[model samples]
Target chain A: MTGIVVLAVAVMAALGFGLYRRTRDGRFAADAAAGDGPTTPTTPTTPAWTAILAAHPDGELGERATLVQFSSAFCAPCRATRVVLGGIAEREAGVVHLEVDAEKHLALVRALDVRRTPTTLILDAAGRELGRAAGAPRRDQVLAALPA
Target chain B: MTGIDPRGPRFTAAVTALIVAAALVIPSANLSALLMFIQGAFFAVGAYAGVQYTPTAVLFRRVIRPRLSPPTELEDPRPPQFAQGIGLVFAVVSVTGYAIGPVLLGQVAAGLAFAAALLNAVFGFCLGCELYLRGLRLKERLA
Candidate 1:
């Protein structure tokens, strides 16, 4: 009897959690640490956009906005995210997609409080973080989250 | 990096969720222990050897993948492998709990594992993978 109850509760809890995650997954939101709004300035020691470009010589920042994606080798959703961000970058003028290997950029990952892979940071031309999404974001969500 | 059919881990999670649920629900403690032990061995292989080497992945490749349409994309195997390690830890605790006098300990451990597996199987959410990344973040914070 106890086992049955436990199993039922487990199933229900898992279902609830899954549903909640589904709604939130890939939905870009303002960084929690930024507090109140998105106007927060980059930290004093925050690496410059130029530094990021220097690290990845092949990458280029967009004239208007840059999509910085932090991904790792182990994350499955990171692949889907890459495609989505890459497509957006291709379609939108003055927008560029930059992929950063999370494993290789430990300092940046920590500095940014990047909690997970497939984290996409939307940066303005000034290199200020506009927003971030922790999971693989949908194309529509990415579009909606972009600054007009 | 070697890519795998992302469905492989989901398939494995489904099987694991079922087996672990059965182990938790069945009336017989001995049977529960046996089921958990079997699942543990599967996790052991997946964690240490690689996610692709698991029996469930083999089954998926041979029996299941053939029937289904090709996966649109493949994923890195490291996250699932890390998840397997987490599962193995719970399996060990659950098995030991069943073997020892305090059976409740076993039930809780198995229950947590079942929750994680079900989440992955049904929603494709990887709790263990999330934990792995969180662990990295935590390590960085402390350092």
Candidate 2:
């Protein structure tokens, strides 16, 4: 029956999306994790910041960690991200949250391969690009991702 | 740009799911056509004027939300509006598909819309919202 088919689709979609929903929110993964290369954590003295910023221009570097968040006006997650990052910046003295308008910085977005609103590019004080999280990150997740 | 109750859209999706499911399961061409029109009209109103104006939203405000405990958080309206736009496209295409030739086209479109709404209703997943973001990414990549 068509109804049976439709209901079956509903059940499958529910299961598929339920699993995706469980994992997709606020989870951070390193860029190198995409490849076979083991993720080597950025050191305090890395010289990669200048080159990274030259390639992907946005905001000034922070003192400790710079959270460069690419946000679109209409996206909902961006709002939540703004709050999360702002709170992090507030509580932590050296950290900074830089919110970029993705609409205005299409070239930068393309350059960074920012595929979603609220895609955060975590940079060290030296301006080196670190890992990125594609959704609105939770407080603990953001805190954990920051440079020690 | 106020935040919606979040549950409001879910309620709307639930209603949409039922209507679309009924339309799909029933074999009457005339009945299906009528159902599509009604559903399409709801989508159009929600798409253009925002979901706050829809009949379902009224139900949420007047009856449902009161019985329920207050939401711990509120969500932006734009993503859901984007979803309504996606719903509008499918509903229109389904109507047009039925008008032209193959009834199956209409059924498939309706089924897709129904499935998407059902996903949001039950699982709190926003497929349309996700697609909108992906489409933006694709456009950025292409340019």
Candidate 3:
């Protein structure tokens, strides 16, 4: 009887663990889908956009284009993105790259609707939006997004 | 950081995941048992790690302790020892269930772990702390 009970417990634990993994996987997929929507609201009074642009007083607009990546120090993916972005920028003199520490600027995140880390916003010389990429854009994808 | 309960969130998530995983693993379930076992292992590790570390104790001494709360007759920040004792028991039982074989009783432990993890992650709450506090109260009663 004792042996039977032990067997029962092990089987149950295994079953419970399986359910949890499924739930977690499902939630991750859902979060990915929701990322595209501009659901998050910005702070009413803060002019975060203006501040961001003003902080870069050099006004050095890129000839290839500009890529700004918002990231946090502890985020692993952000580190990888930084390296990739840097390599891309080095190759294309026109492709200027910049990074902003997200933790220091919550206002900017809300204004830009930046829900996830490693969010890249691309802009042309005149500060017009060319395109944007969330998560880690593939090497080819990053290059492809560059303006000719 | 010394006293702060890291175990609460980790413990809850690991167990919750274990229970949900185990329940889905029916007789026909192929990969279910494997998944649950991994989660169960993580729970065991988390439970053991939580009690061993004393983040709150260190943090209090370094920061909060130095800046005293202006003499308001502060109660002890720690929860009862029994809470952790119960948690330890649960961890051992849950791991044992995983070891022997699959059974419904194992699910009960997994379910408890899952609930604990959810509360910790979503609300920043700690069940371990509650258990410890209960243990302390019991001790006081006995005294």
Candidate 4:
């Protein structure tokens, strides 16, 4: 009787957690303090956009939008995210996809407050952080997150 | 880095979930301890020797891979390997709990491991991988 109860509870908890993650994962959420939000006027002396571009000499900002992905060596979702973001960048005009190795860029990763692998930041042409997603985002979700 | 068929780890997780579930459902403590011990050995081998050497990986390579078409993509093995280490930790606690006293400790440990394995098997959600990444982030923040 005890064993069955434990098994049932474990199954329920796993299912619930999986369902919750599925609903939220890869869905971009706009930053409340970003864009035109009223927040503290104390902007960082070193902006994240400049720091990111400075770190990657080869990376150029897109005319319309940029998708910046932070990936580690061992993350499986990172591989899938690369494919999705790459395909979108290829198909869309003036959209750039840039990948950063989180392991190598610990300083930048800390600066950006990236908590996990395959985190993508959607930046407008001016390099402002419009929003960010914490997992492997779907292609349609990425499209929807972009500014018109 | 050498890439592996991503399905290999998932297959391993499925087997692990079944074994853990069995361990949970079995009424006898001795049998449950033995089952967890076996699973822990597998985890140890996978974690230390590399994921490719695990028994289920062997099964996947010899029996499963040949039957299915080639995978569209391959994945890094490090994350799944780390997951094995995490599984080994829980399995150790579970076996100790069942083999000694306090069967509840064993049950809870095994249950958590089972849930993690099920998540990986069913949803492809790698809890160990997430933990590993989070650890790195925490380390970076501290540094």
Candidate 5:
């Protein structure tokens, strides 16, 4: 029956998501294990931030700093990200705010390892890696990341 | 005889018909692929149209149309504007996917969307309904 097939696909997708989350979580833990505490891990292999920078014509890091957000129109978190990041961008005149539609840019998404909506990559004024957050960042975190 | 709400039943029947069609046609016919492609297109438009007419139908059916209001709570529960917004997004995604992607892949996305729509129609189990609700909740929390 159609219902049965649909149910099978749902089950498979859930399984796949679970496996991916586990693998990604393990990878994070391993990287953290190798790194010193409280230090921002920056590397060329972590090119997600780089691709994000390239998305904006002005580049990732501008005079103030930049918050590049990958978003989709249908994605709910994206709307929330817009609200949260919009406030941040408003307060910081130098911060370059940009958003890319994930659905439209599938290649960029896979290259950047962006699996979720509202993924934000933060960079310094010079475009160097600062950090990134998956969901909406706390106001304090955003403030802390800003350049003096 | 036990009474059943009309809109709910109608939605359910539509969903059932689509699913049955998909099941029967998939793997057996090429035209079935078109089903997947247009599934989201028609569903999003159809659902919007269905919801829009719900209230007016309720008014007419109970008052002028001579069907008495049932005791159950299955009347049109959605706000017209909200339903329309959701439908709009659904329709946009469906149309864009069909436009840009390979015909088969686009149809796959559409097929999946159609299946979800059917689930919502038949069982009142809307897939993205709660996502919007949660988005609103997040907005409220932030505010």
Candidate 6:
């Protein structure tokens, strides 16, 4: 009786977590100073922005904002992220979509403190960090995260 | 990136959850091993050959696919199969727990795995897959 009860409770908890995860759009607000959001840390604890650019495969920043997507080879959502981000890049003249294989670029992924596949880092024209999101985001959500 | 039908894995997860949940409720010694054996085969086939060969996949391809409407989109099978590999690990541990000493340990393992399977079946998100992705990322970072 006790085992069944525990299992039931566990299932309910897992369901709760899964529901919470599914509804969350990968929207990390662009305010670091305000300090309380899903934003990846308030500031860069690593090297300069230019140096970070050098480490990534696409050495050049976008004319306005770059969509840096880190993906693994077998990640399903990475494909979806590609379609969404690539679509955004196509419509917006100034934005560019760049994808890096997380497996191949482990060091860079580590440097950026990426914890998941389909992690997108938004960078300005000067390669300055604007915002970051883990998991696939909708078209509008990505747009909202970009630096204006 | 196996561009397979996305529903197949979910179908299997649902079945796995049902059986594992039943096992938890029953707490039979034979059912314990049976659950492991069944789930183990499913995960091994999914993780190794591909998702197509897994027992539930086969059933889905035959009975379910014929009945339901076609999938609107196809998804990569790797993540769910990776999720299966995670299931296999838990199933193994649970089986070991049942065989060696405490039956409760096995029940606990099954319960944990059942929760994951249930999550995948109901929520469409595989926490096991997420954990696997995190593990891969961590391994990349640590190494």
Report the Cα RMSD per candidate: 2.8, 3.3, 16.2, 3.1, 13.1, 3.0
Worst 10 residues of 3 chain A by lDDT: A25-34
Instruction: Order the candidate numbers by TM-score, best to worst.
Output: 4, 1, 6, 2, 3, 5
Per-candidate local distance difference test: 0.85, 0.77, 0.50, 0.88, 0.49, 0.76
lDDT string, candidate 2, B47-88, tens digits: 899988899999999999999999988988777887988998
lDDT by residue for model 6 (B91-110), tens: 88877876774777888888
TM-score of chain A of each: 0.83, 0.79, 0.63, 0.85, 0.61, 0.80
The numbered model that scores best in lDDT is: 4
Candidate 3: residue A28 Cα off by (Å): 20
Weakest ten-residue segment in model 2 chain B by summed lDDT = B96-105
Q: Estimate each model's TM-score.
A: 0.89, 0.85, 0.41, 0.90, 0.41, 0.88
Off by over 4 Å in 3: A1-51, A55-59, B1-143
| Model 3, span B33-83: residue lDDT tens | 444555545444434544333343344346555575443222222322323
Q: Model 4 captures what fraction of native contacts?
A: 0.70
lDDT of 2 at B11: 97
**Cα TM-score of candidate 1:** 0.89
Clashes by residue pair, model 4: none
Q: Write the per-residue lDDT of candidate 4 for residues A60-98, one digit (tens) a residue.
A: 899988999999876889999999999999999999999
Per-residue lDDT of A43-83 in model 1, one digit per residue for the tens?
A: 53343465566557787768878899988866878889999
The best-first sequence of candidates by lDDT reads: 4, 1, 2, 6, 3, 5
Residue-level lDDT of model 1, residues B100-121, one tens digit each, is 7378888988999999999999
Against the true chain A, what TM-score does chain A of candidate 1 give?
0.83
DockQ value of candidate 2:
0.49
Fraction of true contacts retained by every candidate, in order, equals 0.69, 0.34, 0.00, 0.70, 0.00, 0.57
